[model samples]
Target chain A: MSLAVQPIDDSETINPEAVRRDFPIFSGSTQPRRFHYLDHAATTPKPSAVINSISDCYAQCYAPIHRGLYPMAEQATSNYEHARRTLQHFIGAASPDELVFTRSATEAINMVASGWLKPRLERGDVVWVSRMEHHSNYLPWQLVCQEQQAQLRFIELTEDGQLDLDGTPELFAERTKFIAITHVSNVLGTENPVATLCTTAREYGIPVLVDAAQSVSHIELDVAEMCCDFLAFSAHKMFGPTGIGLLYGRQERLAEMAPLQVGGGMVDSVGDGMEESRWAAIPARFEAGSPDMPGAVGFAAAADYLSSLGHERVHRHIVSLTRLAAQRLMRIDGIRLLPHAGLPASGIVSFTHHNMHPHDMAQIAGEAGVAIRAGHHCAQPLLRRLGLTATARASFSVYNDESDIDALIDAIISAQRVFCE
Target chain B: MIAQDLYKETLLEHYRHPKNRCDGPIQDADAVERGANPRCGDEIEIGIFLQDENIRHVQFRGRGCAICIASASMLTEAVAGLSVAGTRILCEQMHDWFGDIEPAAGALLPNGLQALAAVRQHPARQKCVLLSWEALADAIDKAGRE
Candidate 1:
């Protein structure tokens, strides 16, 4: 593949004032000495396009969508259904029938824990998962296996944060049910070879479910080409609304999967007896109660906004920022940057100061107007593996500029000098 | 600068040239207490020289963030001539002192126990400053427990 380099006039590519004007929150913030935002892996800031979509949906059409018999309801239903189609196209899905909407990626994982994979899976069936998986992907199987009397296996990661392909000799066995892995490491910023991992899992006839929470916004994803059976991601992490996420399962697989929660909007008909009710087909089977139509509309708008900026452009910009941040951080005295920090890192830069507590470092950075995440970052297993209680993390996103990286480095050095001197 | 600047100066002095920062000889020691902050991987050992039921001397040995090591040194100096009740009151007073100061008060502690004042500006560093004291507290608690 020929690597393409876009010219950096910087001015034409991004209008600084226009970009700042888009987000109302930025208007009130002090702007500090230099407000460096490097926590994009946790959650992204939505643009005016997404903000307006939600507001417009509430202002003009705020009614029940599928069940109502009114004009606003018809328009709401049209927009909501169109969102499914939009997401389906975004991820290169074959049809909208495969998309199941849920509150967040955590809830989506729980749904699979109860609905599709759990009932069919029996005790002693081995589920292969990666060590680098976020708690969202790791904990569900832990709980599921505890109740079902099943077993969970862990795949090792190399020093560079990539999956150690040669170490997985146990993957080609009859006992293996499915392999669950994260597409990118939220802490390490390491990208996984999903297409390759998915293809290998198929050799043993095992389906793969990818935790695409970190990968969705950073890289171009083609679920059909990746050949995975299921994918889960949240919109909030991708410059979209919260309380809404997408669970992409293959049409054939979703057709047979059971529903985790059964309630209104999910049922075709119900008898006097509770157990005798018939559920709706495919996508509706997993969706229970009223959907977040307004949030979904905003999410759809977010998807469009990101696409307009060009996903490839966003990827290039963030990769460059990650490289710059990692290089600067690693050069600091007594600081150790974690493995796999680069141009296309998971968009996170994790480091530890020799004798400094991450919490203390975060506090200093906070005082410096440089915001970085501290502590275990909800990846306690990974932390325990590394024998650390906490770490300082600086993550980057599209809105972040080169000066942000400089600000973080400057703040860190100043903090070091302040305490060390 | 606030009176706490005095504390910051004390912390910098003790951290730079730490006093009572070594273990007492076994011949001169009663018992040693070991403590660690699992969060930041800081460890401290408290060696107390006691006479009958009263405290005669106190010292600390640890490797951790500068705040912790300095606080341990200053704490040793503050409680050197005090009774067990006096030491406990000092610890409580130090906690309140840290709570009362402002960041602009400067990095130094205001009073004689000024080495601990940097902790006031850094709420997150309070644990670091209190680690040795907590170990000392636990040592006393264990001595009483025994």
Candidate 2:
């Protein structure tokens, strides 16, 4: 199969107003004012194209895949495989067979830890992760290490909240068998240099898993260039539906791994005895059962929607909004933005007020029809490392404009006035 | 007016000048307990000095939202002079105050707790208003066991 890159028009400009119209949730509401949605890091609102694709699948071509010889079943199977290929190209994977569909990014990480790495690891082996990883990326390694009597190590963050690259070499000594880290932090908005980290881990014969849950929507990913052995991400974080996630692994590593779930669809041949049974092929072996067909259709639609917009343009738009929000939010008195080093924040800005609690701030923001997230953001260890219990976060997406940032700033000021006075 | 209605003047006053916000655990308290809202990381520790089956003194130390801190500050004042049985009744009343049904006739709330009625409008924050009272109940339970 030819893996050719699609041609994109570099000079195309993105009109966020036009893009906002593609999402019905923004306009169908009866509210007097527009809702300022700044929580894209949690989940994105679905576009009309993705929604229509899902409904069309159920209405026109609803059937079980890979089983029936009838026309409907064949259409469903083709659509599902096409969705896989679309995602494969989206992430620049070597082949569609490298991608395995899981329930979510959390389940994808769990599969790698239990099925791929657990059987190969020995007692006293070490798994290294960064301090800024979301709990979904951190807890799987922690649990597997505990169960296997292996050690779990953390690559600490510097004072500016980037990965402490200077202190990382000491944590990657001989016993380090696997390295799991996030490509971008959900809370601190720090984008780690995964390519550099992968190159270093490859030198030590260590397999690395990149959690791209926060990066796939904003940054273009190429697994070959990244040189990481495995990668995981969820579709919901992007513009697709929930309950669908993707895991990409190097062909050689995936070939050696066992299936996490053994079921009807995953069996190549079956007999009464276990010795007579063999698992299915690469992607099918991991999929295990009837797949989420509608989700796959929606996922492909989301991929097409983003591709049409061009990821380069998307990156520029989100980064510009993040920088603007950070600058304006910093001007507010008693509001402190979490420090980042040289790398700019990728569509997220987390902060705290010296006088008001984050929950109160978020509540006030919500009252003004602005949606933001407040709490530990499932990165309690990272917050504890920073000596903070909670922080308010405003994240951006392609549909978010400058007015959203203004609303967030106004809400913060309102909270300050209500509490500090 | 709307802002003051949410963060009422009485509530803000109590938050600014908390009655029994202390530096450490009460040195001579008979019972101590801690409560935390894991979702938001709001935590509070309550200590009670019980003498002659009455709450002689109550002190709290922790970090939390304004609603939680104010509720704790007001809680310390409300339960300080009450008998152990009366404290238990107040705990029951606090739980009832959060319910959809109103308190029965003649079931009066303590004076300072009225400010927290505003919390009912923000259902997401009811937990914040109840954190300190929950800790007080836990301390009373520990004292009973002792």
Give the Cα lDDT of each candidate.
Answer: 0.76, 0.88
Determine the iRMS, in angstroms, of model 1: 4.6
Best by DockQ: 2
Give i-RMS (Å) per prediction.
Answer: 4.6, 1.7
Q: Among these predicted structures, which one has the highest lDDT?
A: 2
| Tens digits of per-residue lDDT for model 1, A1-421 | 0012122333325444455566655555666344676777788777888888899999988889788888888989988988888888778899989899889998888787667778867899888888777889999888888788889888877777677878988775788877888898888888888898898777767888888999788687789899898899999998899899999998887886888898989989898956688899879888899989988888777777666666776777777778888887888898987767644465788998875667657766776677898767767777777767678899887777878877788778766765656
Residue A29 in model 2: lDDT: 57
Cα lDDT of model 1 by residue, B1-146, tens digit:
22234235566567667788774432455657877876666778887776667668887887766677787887777677777776666555565555563433333332556545546666666777878877787766666665
Top-TM-score structure, candidate number: 2
lDDT of 2 by residue, A1-421 (tens): 1223342445656688988999988988565689999999999999998999999999999999989899999999999998899889888888999999999999999999998889988899999999999999999999999999999999998889889879877665899999999999999889999998998889888999999999989898899999999999998988999999989999998997878898968898897866678889999999988999899878878877887777888988998889999889888899888878123569889999899999989988988889999999999989988888999999999988988988999999888877888
Binned by DockQ into CAPRI classes (incorrect, acceptable, medium, high), candidate 1 is incorrect
Q: What is the two-chain DockQ of model 1?
A: 0.21
